[model samples]
Target: MSGLQPITRSSQLSVEVVWLSAADGVLRYRSEAHPLDGGVHPDDAAWHVSGLTLCTPGALLHSTSWRYARGSVVLTYVALPDPDPHDTVAVPTDAVTSGGGPLHPSPAVIPIEAVAAHACRHLALLAVTDPQVAAVAAAESPLWTLITKLPCAPAGTLHPAQTTATAPHTAC
Candidate 1:
């Protein structure tokens, strides 16, 4: 076969998707990426996900999960959004230093589909690079999976807790 086409890394994209239960939903959502600013949401899927990780604050209340699938990975975490009503901040990509010092592991959340695709692309490299990772392919193998799979409220939707009416995206 001819060389597989490269994955898009552009700042823009678009696609339609089906949003089922936030718990066990698989989707085909298309994303539109725009060069991200400080506080606004990402228009692109990759940026959107990475932005999720960045917005998710590291905390004592925060937890971790992992799923070492035979050929895929999905990551998730509890995030703390920006504090002030208009507070736009930035965190380092490699490592972020908090008032206390460098924070602990900040896991990245990639959808199962993305994970599967990555595995297909890097199978050979992965086989030789990390065989042990290949042995376990369950959705609950990695710490990030636990963090992501935990049944949390959906974005822009409300569940059983609060008394006040917050915005849709504030569903926590």
Candidate 2:
């Protein structure tokens, strides 16, 4: 999907995956990663991230972005349900942080609530909100943070125009 962005608060993610072209096909692996902006921090101060690496299995790539708005964070993924009668891959804590690796050995699907909660937690982590804001954010269903301000280019993913708008620094 070109220019496809998921804005859902509770959408299930099958983990960010990396693929290696093997004799059979593309072997996929998953990992645990925080959003570049720590989208789940939920505090009241401005949050900033200089760089973030989304990793899986045999490769590493930097996101096209560096700085993200409090509202810009959204959970995005491709979820694949398990295929079996009664096999299940236990959700791993490491899976959330480093992302899951290898195909799960059972058959199961992620619930929408799980997706929403994770998205909420992610936003909370990358966020800086006071008690009041935090409470509201926490209570917000399909939780998502919305930010409004003059457009500030993300650190790494700044649009070319944004870069051109800045005056070159001349030190005396």
Stretches > 4 Å off in candidate 1: 1-27, 35-50, 54-172
Q: Which tens-of-lDDT digit does each residue in 1-172 have in candidate 2?
A: 2222434674322222111111122212222323333333322111112112223211212121111123244223311111111322222211222112223321133333333223323333433434433443343222122211112222123357744465656765
Candidate 2 CA-lDDT value: 0.26
Write down the TM-score of every candidate.
0.18, 0.19
lDDT of each: 0.27, 0.26
lDDT of 1 by residue, 1-172 (tens): 2222233443232211111111233211122112334454322333333334433333111112223222222122222221221222121111211122123222233343442222222322322344443332223322223223323322213345734564566444
Residue 20's lDDT within candidate 2 is: 11
* Stretch of 10 with least lDDT, candidate 2: 42-51
